[model samples]
Target: MSRTSRVLYLIVCASPRARRIGELVGRAQARGWTVCVIPTPQALKFIDRPTLEEQTGFPVRSEYKQWDITNPLPPPDAMLACPATCNTGNKWVYGLADTLALALLTEAIGLGLPLVVAPALNSAQAVYPAFDRSVTALREMGVTVLYGPGVYGPGPPGSGGRPYDWELPLEALQEKVVRPERRK
Candidate 1:
């Protein structure tokens, strides 16, 4: 397979905002990329495996399965952790990878897969000292952390609507993580 056709591993965290994960997955696959959805245990509470599997046309595996490590295939070409929670972000920064999702991310980073994380959390949680430290560490490690849309989806009128612009994260990923091969 060509470079672009190499596998793309997606780590979807469980959160109310995770409803939008499908859109990201669909868009990536439409660009001639293969996507593997590995939802966090918590994320599965919001989005089921079957639904994600149907969308990505591949079985969704959460924990490290018995046969996976032995396959001996190269790591995925790209890794994206969308709707990454404050918990995961904080844990990652401190190098506390207890769960399979986090462990996979740790491995991906170590293997030099193009990695990006789109965080989704409340403003309060976003500003936690741990969160700040984690973000800084990730950036220092050359990990692209896509700025979120700030506020969740649409809110009540006069509710201060969306905080930041969508282009912030879109452009961040487009410029740093995603590099579609130029078409002839």
Candidate 2:
């Protein structure tokens, strides 16, 4: 499918960066993607639900819809988890779908949808062995995980450093996932 017709599920996690997700949504729309915002339950507190809903023209969904209800968002042609917190990342690797966001991510892996994850955490969190293992496991599962060096590296604990470069995940998706699909 052409990029203009593609649907992208932009999953936001419970990080300070979640506050700036509107910027990412705007950028994705500018690139012709029909973007949908899915935030983790905790991320709800960080983001402006009304603004994002208006921005995307879709409800900001954090929980599963009732069985009788129809899904409001389109099926994703691709998925991105930006500011993917250590908690969510690890849970996803283990196939823990306790939340709607995790359920979608876990299902996306099985569906073989083009997926990219940019982890956001402090150096202390990154240092854990589980973090390294999660990154490796996700990559082995054919998920594009943008971490370390030029992509993104965790800052020190309590540093509250510069905001995450939100565009990195979108850029990666365009190059690694979207562009290749176009050639087919």
Candidate 3:
């Protein structure tokens, strides 16, 4: 089947906000994007898979498909991993790809695709030395990290707080990813 060219692969993690990810798909589709949600293994428990599939007209995949089966979606024009956890973020930093989400992230970074990450970690978790270094490493490599004081601030520890704006990832995708390409 011929795939739409402007595809977006949204990697959803296991945050409480994961349930609302259909909001992201709706927003992206309004902007002429075809969104495919790739969920983390544990994220399935948080999100409504059937609803998400209905929303985006695609499956919310969490595992690697068989080798004989061709990939379903088109190459992503951009990638957004929102509400990322400390574990996911740090693993991405260390080149871990045990999951399809991390594998896609690592490969997308290597391909120089437009990439955005919004972490939902609190202050205490953010204090980890690896978290600091991981954010710095990703930033140095041109990754758009929606973290820090005004953005997705390191809130009080164990508060399970979400970021300031749910739309930040979409905004980043528009500003840093889609819009930049339009200029050419």
Candidate 4:
């Protein structure tokens, strides 16, 4: 497939790292993806909407459009939820679609679209049993979850830990999802 034909839905969740989503957008674009930014409602506060909209050339969609209006962004060829929060992950596991971001993610699973999730949370939340279950469940459903010791180690509570390496998700998508699909 040509590079222009690949559309990537980049979901940014409510995390401190969301502030740097523009960097990820640039990287994905350079990698040949036509990117779209889907920010969780709370993520709006962390991100600069105008900057993201300008970067992606599509409005940062946090809410659903009106019934009569069409969605401006094209359908996703793949998706990556970077800095995914525990709340969103757990909600996704249970098939929650309250928010536009979650709605797209839940539907993506059934649509069989390539999906990747890189969760960002503190050590305290990381230890929660539900988080582990959600991660395992998502992986079982064919989602690439970049978590655990080597991928992303959670820091102590209140300690923000080191900045997350956004390249991890991009690389995982290229290697595990996009390339494999292209070969088919």
What residue runs in model 2 are displaced by over 4 Å at the alpha carbon?
1-4, 179-184
Model 2 lDDT tens row, 1-184: 2344789999999888888889999999998888889999999988999999999888889999999999988889889998799999999999999999999999988888889998889999998999999998998887888897877888888754367676788888887564645311
TM-score of each: 0.77, 0.92, 0.91, 0.93
Cα lDDT over the full model 2: 0.86
Q: Residues 1-184, candidate 3, lDDT per residue (tens digit)?
A: 2465488899989887787788778888888889999999998989999988888888778999999998876778888897788889999988999999999999987888888898877778888999989989888777888887766777686566453466788888788764555311
Give the distance in Å from residue 80's predicted Cα in candidate 2 to where it truly belongs.
0.4
Q: List the residue pairs that clash in candidate 3.
A: none
In TM-score terms, candidate 4 sits at: 0.93
TM-score of 1: 0.77
CA RMSD of all predictions: 5.6, 3.0, 2.7, 2.8
How would you encode candidate 4's per-residue C-alpha lDDT over 37-57 as one tens digit per residue? 999999898999998888878
Worst ten in a row by lDDT for model 2: 175-184
Best first by lDDT, ranked: 4, 2, 3, 1
Provide the lowest-lDDT 10-residue window in model 4: 175-184
